[model samples]
Target chain A: MINRRDFMKLSAVGGGAVFLSGLSQITQAAAAYDDFYFVQLSDSHWGYQGPANPEANNTLRKAVETVNGLELQPDFIMFTGDLTHTTDDPKERRKRLTEFRDIVSDLKVKNVHFIPGEHDASLDNGAAFKEFFGETHYSFDHKGVHFVTLDNVSDPGASIGEAQLAWLAADLAKQARDARIVVFTHRPLFDLVPKWDWATRDGAKVVQILMEYPNVTVFYGHIHQENHHMTGHIAHHSAKSLVFPLPAPGSQDKRTPLPWNPAAPFSGLGFREVEAEDKPFQLKITEFPVTRA
Target chain B: MDLQISKGWKIGTACLAILALVSIGAAHSAAPKTGKERVVKVVAKRFIYTPNEIILKAGVPARLEFTSLDFVHGFKVPDLDIRVDLPPGKVTTVHLTPQKAGVYDFLCDNFCGVGHEEMSGKIIVKD
Candidate 1:
């Protein structure tokens, strides 16, 4: 049974015929399993100190508290990337990563997942990040959904690299064509706005590999804004940042963070809740502000 | 619709395009030798650029030659619509004439190590 919310999401992604035909089959599979949801928090930039976010030090802590305050806690929490600000000093980078890990460890949900953003990994090729977080990229299964975390930022050139692409292809080859796949990465796979460094250089190859699958959704956080795009039938969504918000793509000459508003604290800074329903095979995203206005 | 008018139109368009191309080549070959053109060499490595600050006179053409000593870096001046890729051990040249007198910020858009965000400089164009 398609709900109004599901209908809206489907229509938003050009729901004409291809997606709807598979909906009935997905709805039939709903009887055997229950729906699950996860929280997507990205670009926290924990060690960042700037005028863009006057309350940067306190925002991540407050976000953890806010998530804990939720009525229905998520099954897992995935931090898409940018856990800490980039630092030239390796020691400082590790220190910030350690602090970021400790702060987020306070979250209520124990099954938390993490990936590296450019700020977190590009410096030493994700070496420091691997010390805190186990691996830069990995895949797992949850409630019939295949979740693949990609390491696009570890390379200074913002590429997924040829080796990782082979691994991804081999991994996807094992799954059925209709498998529901969710990809998490720090950078957007498609070239949204290359001038602002919002694009992954080899993202097109990633998109091409996923095009074989019928059900795939990509969630990424680099632009620090909520954006949605479709590469054929696949949908790619960008998450907002916990530290600061960037202006819309191509809206300005520079991709500078929006000025902080004194009257409106924590404006444009928010997180997301993604509910994955198996019956209709839909991922519903609800954006929440870091703090109540 | 007549043959004579059609032929005349094509000939007229061809003559005008040739004239435009010749004039454009002349302007390109003549402008740089006027003695006002300045050449600035910049070296990029790790997270900083050498001689980060550059000054130029408005309306004077300048050539900015960029080279990367380490990783590949991008020299982007968004306001001036200049974006150049400086590969390691390669020299890339960009020429521009600032029509306006103002301070323009340029940065290494490419991610070079950890302090990529701090790799920035300003181009000061004086009136």
Candidate 2:
């Protein structure tokens, strides 16, 4: 049965929302392109070594290759988090950041924004992540659009908390009502399901802050597989992994973090690119395969 | 399908994949002993599980040699209902025996983030 959320998602994509779908659709702007394009690369579990994601088996190495291959230069790059894996280990954590740094070092692009998923912050509530990366939740402006990168995960109980909400309200308040806004995070701001590590605890507060914005889009990583849902004018999207794919949300009882299938090499690992035109920017998504060189 | 688990794997791993914080608090009452009977070693890294799917019979014990090359990860089988954390650089192992005949899904329960949800495979049990 087609669910309402699925239906909304269908409307977003099939209902004619994605400006361009792939590399083949690249076209020159006729008039002033208010459309600014950006790349969203999620779930790149660097440091994970397995046959499933051998292309990124070295973590740092594959990311460089993937980002370098963007057909067109994006306005910026947003990695929604999961910068590392696990806790209780410093060497591995350092390896994760070091590799991330290595990839960033080789990058010829500018302004790469990041957010922490539950994993990177899981060990010590993202103390390690803060040490390496900057603030967990922050917002910025690009062109005529407002971009909010939130910290919805990294807590023990999956709560968005209070401090971040205060920051969000102040940030969004600074933007014009007609200005376009895009919020990026690792976890969904809406409740997909609380019991299964989906929904955000204080996600509602974040939503309230964005309610004033006419054009709002929420992009999240985590969940692995592709998922999209829209509430009011807010659209939530989850990107595919550069590693493996998981079952739909709430599919099993802690029965996820599924393994990779050699038969399905780079099956679910892909990328999402969005171009915004007319200030807010027109968006596009391309699912490029993981190159295993 | 919805993404909830009553919770479960075959093989494979990820970089920022699964944050496997194994809180196996209260003894693993059934922690299989490292015995000399039947043991199987599994190499988990990247995202693909070697030997894709495995068919095992009941009463047969198998040891998993899981190793995480990139970061840390977890190995879980739903029908079998077992979870083991595979930290980077270490060859971790676990033992299990299939109790029924069916296709079971194994997933990374550690929320390795992003691809963490989809990082999984399957286990087939044959009578």
Candidate 3:
């Protein structure tokens, strides 16, 4: 399934098995983690199979392994998106979804929340994503925290349409003011570069609504790397991909497909262990590798 | 490998390869010479390509080795038109020859955001 462009990129890298070690334990551990609980995993890319990360399918299972081993069991797990590569075939997307579900079947945690990326939505604008994973953009409450997920990938790249913004407004209307709100999506709100493939067109409106909430935090994935920034009252955090890392931005002249590195795939992939303190609606993320803790 | 067997294909490839090789060699004649086929190491961890910019000699296919320390990263040189998806637990080698001198750019084209754009660097192909 490699196009001329895709194939060239794939063929350029020298091949060999690269066994990498995950980062050693990182836990600011203290009574601070006694409150709420959540885990953020992104860019599973279930259907993506290549030398970039040969174990792309199994890595998700390993992430689940990390989730199961957490000392403080998360109340739920939030997967931002990019559940598959690019394919408009419903059957292929569904198959990938099925595999995603199967990977979690072994997990000890019962509840896992998810959002969509462009890949999973390629088939009928996330029709497969919604059908397989449930509502794309919706909100819910667990104790004192209000968790919201917006559908930024419903459009071309990362975008939250006008109708969806109206819905987000209506959704926020139901939450109490003091409730700590956490929004999830697949792209960053900042203008990473509108020309290539970074910024989300309608993310500004979503940010506008989010600004209304006091202690709001947004979690996103898509730009398969780790990034953290504070947009006024809203703090944006992007999750690392279980698949591969990408250029920062404009690192290259053109935004092209990165080649497949045979030796290593799990190099930059890590999970964020977020513990939410229920009483005050506060959440803290401690980045950790999926390796045995 | 792309140059053989079929008549039309062979003729086309022979011409392109010869064109590329000859042009590349001509460009190499102007070296004040910063360096030659230097070893550049890049580490990918948690979505970041460390020490992104890699200096090299123009008009020569240099060997660049990269590995991911954390997650999967894609090291791509758009001007050179090369892209490599680096995964953890693997070492990847990319051989590229930038014909035209000057500064050619490389980026984390995989959309490793927030600073993904900043995750870019230059392959200072010294003349």
Candidate 4:
């Protein structure tokens, strides 16, 4: 009963399993493991209180609970941005940021990186966000992969200014041309849709700098939707928001928050989990929606 | 005697009429003049401003009335020093007199969602 096609499929599956097993063994052998995984949670909007999210107060808590309950522990969690909804009062802003930090502290993962969204940075040029999160933009290395977190939100006009670009250039220059690079920011680095303010003013320059690298990937979370784009060989992936979902670019005359359906309370709210292997271009990303337990 | 009384009354009447006319003229002069007023209606939703692009004539005063279709949003033209907070179901008005002829970017200062950064528009002033 096994035809040529069936035999070929079976062989392919068996080979894949063996290859995966060997990869796992290699991953386990490394004491200084190069392969790892991380979670990206963005736009928690911790202090948001409205009908759009009747469960706004509990969303972040639930997200933390969900992360804690995951079967596989993430090496770290990077919150893309919008940790808290903006407030005019500095005291309230600080309080919100503190509350967000305190809540996220419940996550089993100890290493959490944060970047600011326009909400967190636009008010006072990120003075409060910087006070709470420290260094709006910076870079670090993990397991041979270079991770750069840029602060596109801290500037008054959603831009990655000259200084940051210079810093990025200098930082990238030190790495090998073939080094695996992952850039994380809150806003899209390309002109996705200028009318909706989705485009970063100076993102083109940043992309230009990134194009120099042989391997690069960008993960951001301002659009509140799952979107994939590419600039040259670099791939740009946008994650969903932890709070609410936004309309697609230019879908409506105005970009408005999609109403939360009471029936399906957590319809469009979720976080992204990314797994990176030691090999270049071996990143597996999955988006998980928040569901009631 | 009749002639003297009639003449005095006539003079008094004439003086009263003159005073009334002068008061009416003064009131007319003191009244404020109405200038041409332009009103621009803007609806702010989640992440985009309605009528994202606007054109105005320089030296002309304008009233921008902003209303949020949903959520609390903000409208700010940093160059024009215009900032207004728009609560859902409420109308906020911003008065602007553009003296310069150029393009001014107006953005939503309040964070509505992931698309908050993209919620901006342009105000073009023509000479």
Candidate 3 differs from the real structure by a C-alpha RMSD in angstroms, to one decimal, of 17.5
Instruction: Tell how far residue A45 is off in model 2, in angstroms.
Output: 1.7
For residues A91-183, what per-residue lDDT tens digits would candidate 3 score against the true structure?
876888888878877878778888888777733677888877888888887755678888877664345778989998998888655446778
Q: Which candidate gets the maximum TM-score versus the true structure?
A: 1
DockQ of each model against the real complex? 0.25, 0.06, 0.02, 0.06
**iRMSD per prediction, in order:** 3.4, 6.7, 8.9, 6.1
> Rank by lDDT, descending?
1, 4, 3, 2
Best-performing candidate as measured by DockQ: 1
After superposition, candidate 4 runs with Cα above 4 Å error: A1-33, B1-127
- As a whole number from 0 to 100, the lDDT of residue A255 in candidate 4 is 64
Give native contacts recovered, as a fraction, per prediction: 0.44, 0.06, 0.00, 0.06
Best model per lDDT: 1
lDDT measured at residue B24 in model 1 versus the true structure, 0 to 100: 16
Cα lDDT of candidate 1 equals: 0.77
Question: Candidate 2 vs candidate 3: which has greater TM-score?
Answer: 2
In the range B1-127, model 2's lDDT, one tens digit per residue, is: 2222212232223222211122222133233444642544455554545544656665465555566666566676533435656667655655455545667666554555444545666666577
Residue lDDT tens for model 3, B17-91: 111111112223322232655556667764455666667665565656677775455565534435556656756
Docking class of 3: incorrect
Better of 1 and 4 by DockQ: 1
How many residue pairs clash in each candidate at the backbone level? 1, 73, 44, 2
